[model samples]
Target: MSLYMLPLAIGPWQIALIVVIVLLLFGGKKIPELMRGLGSGIKEFKDASKEEDKDEKAKKE
Candidate 1:
């Protein structure tokens, strides 16, 4: 099979290890703030995409 067909192989151990690394690098307090900012950025991106779609539909109509 081609590499493109292969599923991601990450398991619980890998997830735990990554979480530990992030905690060590950013500490517990900063992680929440980072996550909040990331969430807001994603929300803004979604809103922008919806607005763009509306604009495209308006133009086509």
Candidate 2:
């Protein structure tokens, strides 16, 4: 099966369904903690990328 055959664009109904499924699976109490972890992970990834860019610039000098 080719990946191009998939309908990759997500509509509002798909988003709502995904949110509903996540709520059902994780419950209300865990969502905040999950979001916090996700946020921190993204922050660390951004910091790492910035540091890598600085290192590359330093090497080019």
Candidate 3:
């Protein structure tokens, strides 16, 4: 199989455009709520992984 390369260059304008689009789609009021939910989800995932690691260590010992 052959590998395809992606464009590695992204400038400030591209980032600004993406931010603007997100704001437009989510609107000003909803972005904070979405971010809060996203943060909690990520935290929950990390906590679960840590718990799993502790369980594995306990089993091995």
Candidate 4:
């Protein structure tokens, strides 16, 4: 298998267009709620990982 990679082609204009569409669809208030949910989801994932590490350490002891 070749170690060289193919480029996945997404550019700045496409990303900006997507962002504009999302903003138009969701509006400002909904965007904040969506962002808050995203933040909490990330936080929950981090907390879960920390808990799993503690469990592994306990089991090793």
Candidate 5:
């Protein structure tokens, strides 16, 4: 059995089109608020992971 993988390429125009679709769906006013929430969620996840790593190190020592 042979498996073939195709390359996926995304160019500037494709990104611009995606941005346009998102803007249409979310509207300009809500994008900033949504982005802010997403940013905070990501930050919280990182902080939790760091705490877990510190606890693991303390246990090993």
Candidate 6:
């Protein structure tokens, strides 16, 4: 099984609780702002991963 699927990890209820807590902490007013930042971070991470893949391919050529 994948490490991500290991037992004792969060289930649906825990995930729901976490989301609720985050909403409460950041508030509905600011969740979108936080999400925007998160989206940018994810984009940057994906871009970096792709760049690394390209560099590895170039090195093997």
Q: What TM-score would candidate 1 get against the native?
A: 0.89
> In angstroms, how far off is 59's CA in candidate 3?
1.0
Off by over 4 Å in 2: 1-6
Cα RMSD (Å) per model? 1.7, 2.5, 3.1, 3.3, 3.5, 3.2
Across residues 2-60, which tens digit of lDDT does each residue of candidate 6 receive?
A: 88678757789999999999988889999999889999999999999999999999999
TM-score of each: 0.89, 0.88, 0.81, 0.79, 0.83, 0.70
lDDT of 5 by residue, 1-61 (tens): 2234323466799899999999999999999999999999999999999999999999999
Q: Score candidate 4 by TM-score against the native.
A: 0.79
Candidate 6 deviates by what RMSD?
3.2
- Model 1, 1-61: lDDT tens digits are 6687566767899899999999999999999999999999999999999999999999999
Model 2: lDDT of residue 56: 100
Top-lDDT candidate index = 2
Model 6 worst lDDT run, 10 consecutive residues: 1-10
Give me the displacement of residue 56 in model 1, in angstroms: 0.5
**Local accuracy of candidate 3 as per-residue lDDT tens digits, 1-61:** 2234335466899999989999999999999999999999999999999999999999999
Error of 1 at 13 (Å): 0.5
CA error at residue 8 for candidate 4, angstroms: 4.1
lDDT of 3 at 18: 89
- Between candidates 5 and 6, which one is better according to lDDT? 6
Q: Point out the higher-scoring one by lDDT: 4 or 6.
A: 6
Q: Predict model 4's lDDT versus the native.
A: 0.90
Ranking by TM-score: 1, 2, 5, 3, 4, 6
lDDT of 1: 0.95
| TM-score attained by model 6 | 0.70
